[model samples]
Target: MSFASQAREEIARRSTVKACCVRAVCYGIACFAKYFDTKGLVLQTEQQHTAQYAQQMFACCGVEGTVVEKQRPSGILYEFSIREPEQVERMHALFGTTGNETSIQIDPALLRCRGCLSGYIGAAFLCSGTVTDPQKEYNLEFLTPRTNLARDFEALLAEHEFAPRRTRRRAVNVIYIKTSDQVEALLAFMGAEEAAAQIQRQKAVKSVRNRVNRHTNCETANLSKMAKANAQTLLAIRYLQQENALDSLPEPLRQAAAKRLEYPDLSLSALCGCFEPALSKSGLSNRMKKLEAAAAQLKQKREEACNEGDCTEQPAHRG
Candidate 1:
């Protein structure tokens, strides 16, 4: 089932309903229904729970309605109507509607307080609302062709400090909310506590996963940078050995060269850890720099001598 479907089902199946909110809920359903005019009242829905809820509402008010099942590509659809003259008139007067509604509008008189408004809006959502999965994205919206009803709904949301955005999708007015906090709060307000909890839980999981990925990426980059610097240090060490200049160096410099030769895989930072008293990275690094300078001087002199007397390319000294 969709996220919206689950939330709507939860809100619809609420049985311990307040008597006053029952009328508000029914009125919300009527205003957003297929039609609530002089002819009769028609409520079309795909949710069996919604049809049952509506039936329970009317039963409480001593009104009767009928439900007809229609076959559709998706599944069974329900068409509910109350065509009885007295029943239709009673339903309209319950919410202060004129019983000849040409343009649907929210009846402020029906919504006595925040609780009544929440129940009314919840029913209105059951009539024309959908929400995206919180794990994927945060989007909850109501779509209705009635412009006046949509405008009133927007105003209601704003009065309650909900930041709603409005747009037109073809012929319908789309009132959508994109923030997770607002979406979760609204769903909980409408009595879908479990669905709101899912949003909160998934948000925390995503945050932890993102932090782990960033830390792993940082370590990998540091390792890569260390490997490149070590390659240059290795080349200079091999050259000093070939020139037979390794034994002639200062003891600290000789030890630095010895460590690199023994632990060829270690970076300068790791190589520092192998010293008897544990050398600092800069201490080992300065030793390597001085050795490289000595090798460079010998290399320049060797190249000049080869130009004069044809000296041969010598093999690297492994020891």
Candidate 2:
């Protein structure tokens, strides 16, 4: 039979059995109703407790986020990355305490994939834990074809606690454990709650590492480009300085040229290019040459002025 059909039949059988069993043991209908009401209240209380504990456990693992559902082809899954190496080690320690010999594998390789860890965790719960309530599930349809291991593990987990329910929506089944203390113990024993936080941290670290590497590479490339552009500009500026380019230039250009002359090897091209509307390389070259010619003329004029002054001041000399 198809899995859905089998599920339907199983559900029907269980319902009938439950109805009959309850009716047989009941002294009165009112008493049965009361019992069911109390059970529901207890279940709700446990769910709330579990949610709080899940939060605390996640916090203890140093994960400060809510548990999020991630969709996959085969089914929906819960996922968190380990950011702290210590949390990972703590998780490893939790799994180490379990004495049950199930095929629940937790290792460095498993750490990379949250789905894998979830599968193992679900399996471990199934093999050893009791399910007091039967409505919790982890959806299998979100998984890929033939990943029966995860699906089966989820089934076993549900069977141990409560009946699995199917919904039209494709999301990871959020099974609320009915027994809060048991859930806490399981978490403590398996180190799953902390491990969940650790997983979140690990993923965060990997993301950061990738970002840093990418930024570093980009910066390196940009720096190289800047250096090349600066080198060309500096070369032009030095040539102008050597040729005495400053005094011949217009006021603004002359000041810029003087500044370039002060650092003779500095790139005038870069300074010109940095302007709002960048100058063409040839424009920069022309401007520098003009400044050089002007500076040389000014220097010569100064020298002549000084000589004329000295000639005027000198006494008729010498015998």
Candidate 3:
């Protein structure tokens, strides 16, 4: 089953014994169902389990309904309709609706009982709510064709401290929550504890994976930069030695160069350990810079004096 279906099934199977909550559940089912009018009250779902649960709720409201099945391109649809003359009148009285209102809205009077909101919302969800898989994204929404009813639903969510946004899609009003925290919270609030926990677990796994990827990328970039820098330093050292300018460098510079030549692949930081006193990375870096500058100065001087004399060597390190 889809994740949303799992949540709906979870909601549908929960036990509610309180009279107020039971009435609220029936109201929620009526509010989001396909129709709730004098002719008949109808609730439909692709889930037979949910259809069965709705029939039970209809019975709780002093009404009787039968499940009707229909085949569609997607799957079989199970509809529970209360059309008997006596049952229809009881259904209307149970919900406090006359089928004459301007627009279908959640009656505040229905929620006068404490702890009834969650049961009501949960029932509404089994009818018109859907939640995406947490691994794919964090999204949960409730749909209704009536704009006023959508607004009322949005207000109800807000009163319970949930942050929701509303928009229209294909002539349907959508009340949605986009963040992980809210989505998880709503699922838990609606009594889908396992579904909510799964979302939490998926979120944690994704966070860890992203953090590890960033660290790995950062380390790779640093290694590439270090390799390029080591290559340039080694080139300068080899040219200085070829031109017979190594002996002119200071004793400390000579030591840094000698170690670098001995271990051509070692980075400056690693090379620090080869020294007797274990030079700091910054100290080794400075020495390497001076050596490169000295070599560059020598090369420039030789180029300028090449035509004047056989100036192929230097006795003093160039500044």
Best by TM-score: 1
**Distance from true location, Cα of 221 in model 1, Å:** 3.4
Provide the lowest-lDDT 10-residue window in model 1: 92-101
What shift in Å separates residue 78 of candidate 1 from its native position after superposition?
1.9
lDDT string, candidate 2, 1-319, tens digits: 4322222222222211232222211111111111112111000111222223333333443333233455667665433233244543443343342223233222333222333333334323322222322124212221211123334534644644534333222433233333434443333333344423433455577689999999999988977776675555456555555655534446756655545545544455566656457766677667656654555565576679778885333467867
How far residue 304's Cα lies from its native spot in candidate 1, in Å, is 6.6
Model 2, total clashes: 33
lDDT of each: 0.85, 0.39, 0.89
lDDT, model 3: 0.89
What lDDT would candidate 2 get against the real structure?
Answer: 0.39
Error of 2 at 289 (Å): 12
* Candidate 2: residue 24 Cα off by (Å): 25
Residue-level lDDT of model 1, residues 1-319, one tens digit each, is 9888999998887653677787788888887788888867888899988887877777787778888888999899998888999887887677666676578878788888777788888888888888899878899998888999899999989889898888999999999999999999999988888999999898899899999999999989988888777777788889999778889888998899889989988888888899999999888889888878888888998899889876876658856
User: Where in model 3 is the C-alpha error above 4 Å?
Assistant: 60-62, 98-102, 135-137, 244-255, 274-279, 286-290, 293-308, 312-319
Q: List the candidate 2 regions with Cα displacement exceeding 4 Å.
A: 1-191, 258-319
Better of 1 and 2 by lDDT: 1
TM-score of each: 0.84, 0.30, 0.80
